[model samples]
Target: MVTIKDIAREADVSPSTVSRVLSNKKDFFNPATAAKVRKIAKKLGYRKNTLAANLVKKKNNIIVVVISSVETNFSDQIIKGIQSEAQGIGYDIMYMYTHTTNEEEHKHILETLISRQISGILFVSVILEKENITLLDAAKIPYIFVSIKPDNEHMVIGSDDQEIGYLATKYLINLGHKIIGLAGVDAYPYAGFSRIKGYQRALDEFGIEANEKYIFYGDYSYNSGSQAIKYYHENFSSLTGIVAASDSCATGILNYAYDHKIKIPEEYSIITIDGTNLCNITRPRLTSVTQNFRKMGSLGVRKLIKLMEGKVNTKNKSIFVPVKIDVRSSTARLTR
Candidate 1:
């Protein structure tokens, strides 16, 4: 292996000088000496051992990003944000996937990260249970959450889910639909619960009774949407509007409606959250609440960096990005 000693000898400099140059210790050497050392190191094909080097420095530039095994369009956009921000600050990302909500996989991944002494971790839509959090705390590995936040106040960032829910539900109400139903997925507690509350709040604002019978919960799979719609049809046939938890779920309902020959808009109006590309491609096209997931990811990395750097706020801090509704063909005025 090409070593610093070889470069030092070839460049007619001491090993210490070569070391300083290779490590980019700016104050340790003159410009000419640094330039000479770099030139000779290149010529001699000397490769610095990153692992050994980091061992001495007690630091690494790698950050681990934990994501769920079931990938979503929102997940992809958040990843792009993370990549852009991490690269901007001289850090690299290593993706780790959790096969399910099982905490064992999470524990194993956390242990691996701790063993490797990775610089930091960015959790994308995965919430760490108390045990895992305790482990991370003991290991002193700073992490930031994106797309989801735990009960504790910590460095986390996400979109304003309640606002999206309110806006969509209110839109339906404005179109003269009173018997509106909510089609929600059971996944993502932070997003799902907040949105449900928002839906309730909008109903309360308009002096409408909050009925549990009108709420349908799904597993976030495509089948969940169709099944929820079927349940709604059988029980609450008077349902005139729906605020779906996700675009994928909305698409499922749209497909079911087409298959069952249920006329949209004339009979029912629908809006979904997470305005991914799937919204535009559906037959009638879906109106959706758009959250800037890319920004959420970028902000999460920045927050983790701040924590890693020992920047402290008086209390734990979280940033919430704003959301907007994208009007589309799937919704219309109540014809009845």
Candidate 2:
């Protein structure tokens, strides 16, 4: 709780001089004096009252990040990106998680954020409802959606999910596998549905008739992957390849296959989305279409900062980061 007054007294200087030196107002003091004040402040364990300073400035240099409850494998990487960018620009980040899609809860979160006078918001895989949008609009709070694309027009930053699907499916197709199954893809209007469409597009382009039975719709969870394998085993035995919705889902499939004595890459070639570290740790390893999640996070913060600074451009409303495929042992050419 040592204050500027304590440091000033120790340095034998006025409080205002200490304040300017500590705040980096260099025009008022020389480097030597500034260094002396800083040294003394460090010695005395002095801490600045950021809350009081922000109150006087009428703005908080804090950004709130809202994350969905269904945390993905790459979420930590995204947060790392956000933290690196925000820290470089002297802004602090606060995190809040939304465990449910309840509108009342969303409203409460929004109200709490507004009350804190946060500079902006970054949403990670959380879709905003109409009421939540209205509240943000009325409050004039800038927000950028990350990892999930909302239905309406807004600031969004994520990988091209459709391209990811297309790339994954096409990779399997190029390996001479026409019978490919899709696992753990949801029908929700997000990455899952878009990826499904991409899967269909690749199938149509390659003249492979897509069988509805090959599609297993489920959330991108490990359990979903296991259930998908069970469903495919029962209904689509002729499938030679499978595209999973996530790395975790792919791992689940691998585990299930091991338990059921299904040979990987020989009996079933699997390609998963989200090229996270989990892909590398699996037994056979997973080949995956990798999304630039870290780039998405850092770019989202940059875009939100632009919006908060009133530099909004009508043309740059959405940003789609690129996706790439990582070759691994889980996938091989159709050699049956």
Candidate 3:
């Protein structure tokens, strides 16, 4: 281990002088002495320990944003938000990726954050269950939740899921499709439930019965969407429309219909959420509910910074961004 004593001996200075110079104590050394100390420290390969410095300061300018999964398009946007805010505020960022495998990793991540003295943490769209919350509480660091959520606990900001669901379904309902379906998967986190509720809200508004069979749940993957379509085809006899919670899932639906010889809109219509550029590249440009993730992510960072600075309050201090549906080739009036 390289010690201050070694560097001081090499520099021909007292350990106290070395410490004062390395800590950048302004008045402790004259310019000539400071210059000699700097040269000696450099020659000795001495580097200031950021962790030790942060410990003495009792807080860190470093903020770590941890996400459970990084595969989603929207999660990327949340990251963009964090990076933007950190850059603007001049805070260092340590990005942590924790794949959803176990409860222990979440605990480990939290403990590691405290051990390193991370000032704040931003959780983007991945729910931290009770055990994980207990871990965070033990860490005692301020945290802000972004995108994915469970009812009121930490500071959260994301697009309004209820309105998003209502809008997509309402769009289909307005297009005169009577047999609209809400596509979901239990493993997809909160998107499934929220989108289904949105679909139900639209159905209730139209005085239609909330058919349980029309609600299909599968994994929220493109392949899952393909499987979901097959399930719907076999079960829902007269399904004319489907609203997928994810654009990736919707892309799956598009491929399934094309491959299985089912007509889209002429036979069925589908809409998805999170209008990433990928939607435009698909065979039939997908109609989707668009939320600007870059903006969302940037705003999350701003909010987190405010919270860290005591400029923002936690209770009743959430930001709900609006969402818009992008109409494209995949959706059409229920023909045939």
lDDT of 1 at 331: 92
For candidate 2, write residues 22-94 as lDDT tens digits: 8888689888899999999999988889999999998899999998777357687799889878877878889
Off by over 4 Å in 2: 8-21, 24-37, 100-102, 314-316
Worst 10 residues of 3 by lDDT: 184-193
| Candidate lDDT (C-alpha), each | 0.82, 0.87, 0.78
Question: Which has the better TM-score: candidate 1, or candidate 2?
Answer: 2
Which number leads on TM-score? 2
lDDT of 3 at 256: 93
Candidate 3, lDDT over the whole model:
0.78
Better lDDT candidate (1, 3) = 1
lDDT of 1 by residue, 51-143 (tens): 887777777778899986653456888888888888768777899888436688899999988988899898887878889888998998888
Lowest-sum lDDT 10-residue window in model 2:
309-318
Model 1, C-alpha of 106: deviation from truth (Å):
1.6
Report the Cα RMSD per candidate.
3.0, 2.5, 3.4
Clashes of each: 0, 0, 5
Give the RMSD in angstroms, all C-alphas superposed, for model 3: 3.4
Model 3 agreement with the true structure over 87-201: per-residue lDDT tens digits: 7675788888885435677778877788877778887766677877877768767787777675565667887777788898899888888888877545454656776777789
